[model samples]
Target chain A: MTTANPQTNETVETIHEETVETNHDDHGHHEQPPKGIMRWILTTNHKDIGTLYLWFSLTMFFIGGAMAMVIRAELFEPGLQLVEPHFFNQMTTVHGLIMVFGAVMPAFTGLANWLVPMMIGAPDMALPRMNNWSFWILPFAFLILLSSLFMEGGGPDFGWTFYAPLSTKYSGDSTALFVFAIHIMGISSIMGAINVIVTIFNLRAPGMTWMKMPLFVWTWLVTAFLLIAVMPVLAGAVTMVLTDKFFGTSFFDAAGGGDPVMFQHIFWFFGHPEVYIMILPAFGIVSAIIPAFSRKKLFGYSSMVYAVASIAILSFVVWAHHMFTTGMPKVALLFFMYCTMLIAVPTGVKVFNWVATMWKGSLSFEPPMLFAVAFVVLFTIGGFSGLMLAMTPADFQYHDTYFVVAHFHYVLVTGAIFSIMAAAYYWLPKWTGHMYSMTLAKWHFWCSVISVNVLFFPMHFLGLAGMPRRIPDYNIQFANVNEIVSIGGFAFGLSQLLFLALVIKCCRGGEKAPAKPWDGAEGLEWEIPSPAPYHSFTTPPEVK
Target chain B: MTASTQSNKKLITYLVLGCLGMFGFGFALVPLYDIMCDTLGINGKTATTAQAYDQQVINKSRTIRIEFMAHIQPGMKWDFGPTTNVLEVHPGELVKTAFVAKNNASKRMIAQAIPSISPGLGAKYFHKTECFCFQQQPVDGQSPADFPLVFFVDPQLPKDIHTLTLSYTLYDITEKTLGEALTGPQAQGVTP
Candidate 1:
């Protein structure tokens, strides 16, 4: 409450006044970040919206987790008990959609909105109003998607890929809603990406060079670019599906002279980069966490940045690898195979650099670092599976099977989602001005690590045994693996509740935190006071 | 250099690796592009109604009747999906069927369903079919992928262009792979 400098005091007062006017558009001239529940409904502040996105993402994570439980449950004994085949399919389809869009993506965006301006010493987002709108649109997108499940024919039973004829000729009425919902989500993503792009370009402090910015910021910059480019292609693919289903176009028809295979071509074009869109930022997050805890600069910093971008570029060329079994010619198979395998080169650099950063360093096993270490281990497992799948011949055995499911769940749930959980733990003190319950956080971490592996690993065995995906029921021979997979799924689902409890408990009230919670942490972000101000860096900080 | 300058240098060092990545993928493009085009069947002619259709396998066999007109190729001997058909044949092997495609813009357009009839499980190869006898002939006046109906004779002449009729009752071969091509596996996790 003490301001030694008149200029600093005056600037705060000015920021407060302008914020009040902005509040008129938000909570309508209310003081103090719009206190009541109404604040969430009527707040434009980047920090508030960022918080909203984080919470929403976590909630959806649970919902998606429960669906995964159903999958695991059904697999538990091999007999179809917990849910029906069609509904089981709905669970898989919605589970994939919700976790990817509703949870992980939003969680990262929340972190970015909270961190980017602080890291670069900017006042707020580049386009504040659009940021608010983007956050608001996601809930509606998911609602429409979820509601489609209970619809007469079941929600989007065509698998997340929504292959044509299957989607066009056989899909239920709710597909129209699914198409629209995806449309809105894409709009939200594109606008959100554009805002991030502009903020990074124009609003940095006077001397924060691009190279000087943190790795998290750099990876997100690339991530945002990937978003802008591919979100549109998703929109295009879905639009073609829309017309083909209802409007009578033949974009994916083999009979009307259109090749159904073209559908995979278009979908994966958006899809491949999208997976990178999820992981690139995680690469950035782990890069930040490892260094802060290790008391060392990131190993091979330039190499890390280059590796992240390289992965992004390569994402586009590997799209057709997903379509290898759908009747493609021989040469295209090899090309995708080779291009896909080559992607591992840059990815390998990233993994090596993470380990090298930890080598011989004074590493502390803090909660964030614990999760990061788990991420490196498990995500690597996922990555290795990906490499295996990349072998064109090997993929024949893996594609559309639980093995494919197992691979992505590791990369996504452990790789990306784990990083987001780590980011929350690392920054909670800074955001809440109070240290969270560490005992609870460590509980959440250990539980998630053990449970997540249990949840995803057994599927690999089943998949290798030739169990296909997207089917509601399986033959009885697969009972043992299904049972183990289901038990693992429930354990993983329950573990996430601890994360929610820790986060909520911190937000309510806790022991006061010092501004720089970690001594080794370095960034413009750490320089700011704990519970980062409604507006940090009203005047930008110097780079050095 | 100060630590800051050194760190900045390290960042730049890695960025060059990114450029290497670009070139790396750029190298894979040509061969990958060729593979993508070929496997996707982008180069093969789109199977037209006239191109003789292949026959299907009858497992739990039941007679399913299918009625559609196709432009029969003159020289190519093709079979429909199933086996029962009576062609109104003329002396010159005169090919007869509906060639004009009615564009019903108001409702769904019904393209001619070229029928394919062959042997049951472990039956003879789907070498030819009655309905598939229709071939995609790029007639002098027709549009893209359009083929005129053509029929040939063994030293027999009936080229009057009329009264030649081919008819066949198609059996159901649905849910069966008409045939498996040499395409490899479906690549998983291509999504970014």
Candidate 2:
């Protein structure tokens, strides 16, 4: 292995020498990253930015999880036991906002940052300095949102959607801060997406054709497009909310010739595609991991690519499915319902492809595989419920109910968050140069898989029983189920600490990992040395 | 610039333009929604102009229940409601009703009432010859203003619908009008 390492290093050095001779005028000088805190602050290295994003997302995950804890604790019984109703509303709102924007989206971007350049055999992300700025913006944006909780009227209480009239006229003074924070977050996302798109387009190694790119790369390409298209729409929505509140312009005010439902229209236009943005990258990560563990090449590579692109395209027309209960005309409702259900086709194609990949192959259940398999099962459950929600008449009953909550958490927590966990476990050895404790990882998985169901499954029953979501208190009948859900929530929350331990232990020191930890894995990323160097592929590799 | 740098510039320009285009589209949804609602006759949005329906055929066979509802938007300090909640009127029969809107604010304000009809399919059939919702109503400080609506349910009204809700949501448009006034040339004479 040592001899093999030196041989590869010699070839890399020769390639670098040749590239330097050819392109001396373009690259200027390559400098080592500065020391200590400033290294993190001033660094434009993709790895450094990727590390920052991962740590930032983990911290936010905990913060959002803590808010979820409060929500569950309050709902443990019939009456408001832990917090005031208004504060409970803020908890639900901020928890959702943080988990979606702060945790899941950034986690995916972090994964993109770490993997995209290496997978494509590029030196680093295109536009690295802008990458730094994009990551740095998130912490401050979230700080503004979190600090709004202490304000006089309290933080955003109208749920994460922040439907207008409630958000504009009746909201606290801190709403301005919420608007600006969201604006900056949107700016950060757009910049990050542009950076990804540019890198994928401009920085691919020689002989790496579009079809030859890995599934992870293909998915990020589509996700970047979705982000660039929709983040601006979110910015516009917030700007309208800002003007409606401060200025006399009545965009959502009916007397001013504006309709409140129009706010939902604009928001979900951005918001629907935004949901796909969070999940498509998860598909990419799972796609990578499933093939690695199953000991097979992916079942239908080009079909998977087409499936993702189709889903992204279909996302735009399905926004109004979120507004079925908002009193849409029958024709509009029917149009939205059919468009939303059409998403199931491409989504089903992805699931079938994954299942087909594992069929008749020697499959191993490593920690990553466990999480990926779970993601497939649970995310499909979420998708099935989503199909149910797409039915216009049925959605009239399910809208704003815990059934909706269960549907999303099944997708997001088990779907997006679980995939992030899978990606982390899948790549931790490569990132840390050491293997994580598998026994502990298995425990974390079992506990999480069991507890997550406990947490979200009963929500379907509660919703079906006519318990509304975003409420602080419920009647006595819901008490028994709420307790079970709370226990699951707490258990799920605690199990993450085990994951934290595993990551920390691995990072500190553990059994050494090889350059390619997984024998079945195939990628440019696996070809590099473990704990990838500060600079990788200074000269792009020949893909063939 | 080198070829790579030139392509980078082109890609960046495309992305930036795409972002701006979508941003503009978000704002454009406001007008697009209005146009869509106007065309589809959905979202309870009533036509602004009075429709010239065929008044010659009076089919007195069916009685349709019309429910009147009023909403006072926040920031508009007013007491507004229909004097009569429900009216039983035969199809093709003209009916008249009054809505009392009182501006309880300390200062006089200009208010606009936008009307919407429920069972949105019924919007085309419901014709208004005269209605307060046709124009903005300016109320003096702390005074009540009575506005009348005159309309007839179309003789060709669909059979499946039993009741239709007609709602008017009132908004304070004083600042908006005043802001426009300040921008216009008329503000120069008033300032002196």
Candidate 3:
């Protein structure tokens, strides 16, 4: 119910609280709740906020997953199975929105809230109250969005990108609400990111220098900066949409001295960075886990840091790759094409660093390692496809096709989601004070890996055959691929059930976990007791 | 903790003022937006800066469906309907066009087509919106996209900025604009 604030010379909690003395003058335990519902509502503690974020995102993940289920079922057949074409379009749009905003991103934030302070030997986040507000705003924002589906003309059917003219001229009456909701979501994200950047930059313990920080924290620092940079641009884009739709201004209208193509320019400028925002934390997670399971010091540790930084810098310029097929000038296209291709070198460095980290060092394929290994293999596959997509001429063929769909899913599902799964397994013992069932974890991983590939791999062929994306219905020529994709989707969806069961069962109780479960695990976090105390390192841990 | 003491009061003040400003702006935006779209809602009708007709036209690797309109007087029904379908011409072959224009109005109506690019961006590289092809063709029609736009000129047309709207209701080979119009006559004019 209360934040744990350490007293400094300038602002002393003890002096302030004693000045307005109550029955309990103790600052630490002052008027906290009766320990049940009150704990969550008025809580400013990092652990509490982290738990709330995790649970909220989990619930949203299921809701988003259900929407995906409806979409896959509809695409299960040649003709539409259950919903109207427009309704089907809404499902695809919402599913993506929920998954991106509501699921993958939030999960990482939750992990950050819990682990960052512990990892760096800080007592709490730099701005704990703002952290609470950031977590709280998301549910309401999503509520406003999901509720729009029932309004007069229905919710956003203009795809998740909300392209103009369609979003502006043809979109339904509820679009105003959509804009407002996005504005709120952007606010929440910006606040959360600012808090992360401040904490990572300023709040690390005395000896936890930049180089000494864990890979996960380093990547988050970069991701937070990316969020700060791009979320505003997204706001700018949506603001333009609002003006074009409602006001006389024509930022996107060609006749209004505006260019709809300009909207893409602005959008991908934000979006290309957004893709990395979702995955860089995953990179941090895999970097952490691979070394722990390999029983060795991370090979080329400093090189890994430099590689991540370089990749982040490179991400800013390569945004035009997404706009390659959007009728940009030829010279611009050539520039972006080469610039986009150039990202592979830095990305390659990280992959090489990871492989070298695990090279011939008493390697163990625990559940975390299984997911981390899957992340490397599948993410590389996604990366290879991304390189192919970077080619200007080939991009023309692949733009907005199922190939784009396959490409992003590999990155999002296997890259981001797999890392999350790995993080859960990697840190479950530490969090729950109990070991998770490894057999169940393995079952979850294998089923997911197999089904995910089954779901996404065929999309490449379909895309090559010119099956366009974001369409509710396909011609009979694509019937088989669609069917196979549907089955894969179903299997992937079902595989998640095993994961849910395993996580919940572990959280309840299991074999007792030790303080340092992995032989090679070396971090401020592992040095703490299993099931970390609510108030950890009130006095900063002396990092050696 | 040290950071909070310094930034906390400033942060709270900023958030409160920010919220008030946002609320005020949010309420004001709806009306402001409505006015802008109505007055300046780009219907894509603008004067064509300049043009050249390549009558000899040798670059016919592909055939394109095009829509064209001519202004006539209201109540003056055209004997022939709109000419808005594909006109197939051979590479380097000369092509010509004819459009019926009549005046059935009691007063004279003057009109001019704003500048435009044809085939749009849809033809080349397909930026879709950046093609810069929406022009307000001077037409005495109900609207440009309705086709065979049977209309009358406004006698009060100003000499300065005589803006007009011309929308070409493009239909795919299998699709017909007439059917689309019947579905629910969405106003089509200059595309913004």
Candidate 4:
């Protein structure tokens, strides 16, 4: 741990300045939060809000993972063993909704909340009171969604995509609850995005130029724009589904001059960018981590920025690739196919740059570095499979198959979720002021990496053999592979518990940490103390 | 308010507007999709109404197969199918066909049929001079109703297309029709 930089000394002085300024605030507490539960409820502190988000995401991760366990247990054999078929569908649907909206999106937002202000030398988010509102609304939203399972018809079983006709005409009574829950979630996301954008645009410390800003900040700025732009489109999608089901607006019913396929078009329009939204911040995290562990300045920083921007821009155009089998015109098929493949160029540039940073450098296999390296390799595999699915002719076979399922899990679980785990390990010491048990982290990593592959990898084979997804029962021919995947699924689910334990142990107390826990780490965050001060940089610090 | 606060207020306003605009755009996509499909002859959508045919441009050399299909949407208690299942005709020749629908329910029911043409590229050339799908049909209890269609394949249809399918999916719109009948004209103070 090194704190040799002169900037660190300047930050220590500013901490005192921040304490003086805290007295002027409405809360009237300096370096200490108000007592009890209301401290979390009413507090506008960014770090406190960040903690709430991370814990909420972790809790959702476990709940969603438990639902996944039910799915895998039922599919453990060819016969339906654990739950009914409809219950299985509900598991799959809610699992997807929880993981996407509940776990991944909020986790990224949580990281932004904690790290963005510290990295950019801002005292707090630009809209602090609104930020509190954003965080508070999320739990109520998920509660509405989860509670719908107990309703007469069970929760949404129409899959996370929730294409029309299935979601509208054939759906259950819980459809209204699902729509309302999604609306609330979208509102939370939009407000959170607005807060991020305003903070970055207005609150950067003097001398922190656009080009010099950290990649995490840069990636988040782009992600925030994406959230603002597309979340509303998702709101529009669910609203139409609501109307078509309840109000007879027929926005997606052909009998009323509306096309069900249009629901897919609008959904993927928002959805494709939503995928990038989950991963782009992961890219920023890996970019930050790889350079640190490699003991080198990141290779091609400008190119990394351009690549993220290009990927975001390309996301909007390539949405219809998801609809290749929907009988679109040949021209649309070709257009979407070409546009989807173009995303690979910028994505490729990012992968190569990460490898280049690690090339011929003093690389160490810390927990963070190990996960970052895995993210690069496995995310590329996912990217290649995405390319395969992007081809019009090939997609005709892969559509709705477990191969499609396998592709996304590789990207999301191994790509986005892995980077999140890496970030937790990298900053845990700084966050909790104690190092997590290294042995436990190693065991957690090895178990997850091996089992996740076993879980998702065989699905590609099952799909290639023509097994469909979202079904609890399959032929005896698939029995062996299904068993293996189920075993892997259980193992992967259990491995996450070790992570929870490690976080708790770290928080309770372990090896004390210094100002900078990693020798090669660079940022304004490292310039401050470990367990970053309650209020940092009330008088903004100059970057240069 | 400070200058920064004022600027933040402006940015927030713009972002809120962007969100509202996108919501409007989502609704607008319904019409925009129709217009694009009509102009591009995509999505297997046929013409909204009848189009005229020129007798002089009939292609005598080519014989084309036109297959008709009718389906009753799920939950609709109506028996429906094409009376003339298939036909062989020269391009630009007028063809008359009929579909029969019987209400299985005890009361009269209003239904609408949506028509689609296969080999979507052939859609622009498959002109319906008159079609039952142009308006909703109300069928009496247990009685079969005959709905007629008059159409022609344009002589300008591509040489490669030798066969096409026209399918109609019928949906029960009785509830919607009844609801509209009560509220539509009467709510607007128009007397029948």
- Model 2, which residues run further than 4 Å from truth? A1-32, B49-54, B61-63, B73-80, B90-92, B101-111, B138-145, B155-162, B171-192
Question: Which 10 residues in a row give candidate 1 chain A its minimum summed lDDT?
Answer: A1-10
Lowest-sum lDDT 10-residue window in model 2 chain A: A19-28
Tens digit of lDDT per residue, candidate 4, span A1-544? 1333655445434544444554356566546777889889987888888989999999999999999999999999998777989999999999999999999999999999999998998888878888899999999999999999988989999999998989998889899999999999999999999999988887777678899988999999999999988999899999999989999798999999999988998999999999999999999999999999999999999999999999999999999999988788788999999999999999999999999999998999889998999999999999999999999999999989999999999999999999999999988887888988899999999999999999999999998888999988999999999999999999999999999999999999999889898898999999888888788777777787
lDDT of 2 by residue, B1-192 (tens): 445546667998999999999999989989999888878778777778666645886677788999999998765789999999999998888788988888898886777788888888888778998788877676778888887888999887789877999998887777778665434443111110
Could you give the CAPRI-style class of model 4? acceptable
**Model 3 docking category:** incorrect
Q: Tell me the tens digit of each residue's lDDT in model 2 across A259-345.
A: 899999999999999999999999999999999999999999999999999999999999999999887778889999999999999
Question: How far is each candidate from the true structure, as Cα RMSD in Å?
Answer: 12.7, 4.9, 9.6, 4.1
Ranking by lDDT: 4, 2, 3, 1
Score each candidate by Cα lDDT: 0.71, 0.88, 0.72, 0.89
Superposed by TM-score, candidate 1 places the C-alpha of residue B67 at a distance from the truth, in angstroms, of 24
Ranking by TM-score: 4, 2, 3, 1
Which regions in candidate 4 have their CA more than 4 angstroms from the true location? A1-26, B179-192
For every model shown, what is its TM-score relative to the native structure?
0.77, 0.92, 0.78, 0.95
Candidate No. with top TM-score:
4
For candidate 3 chain A, the 10 contiguous residues with the lowest summed lDDT are: A18-27
Better of 1 and 4 by TM-score: 4
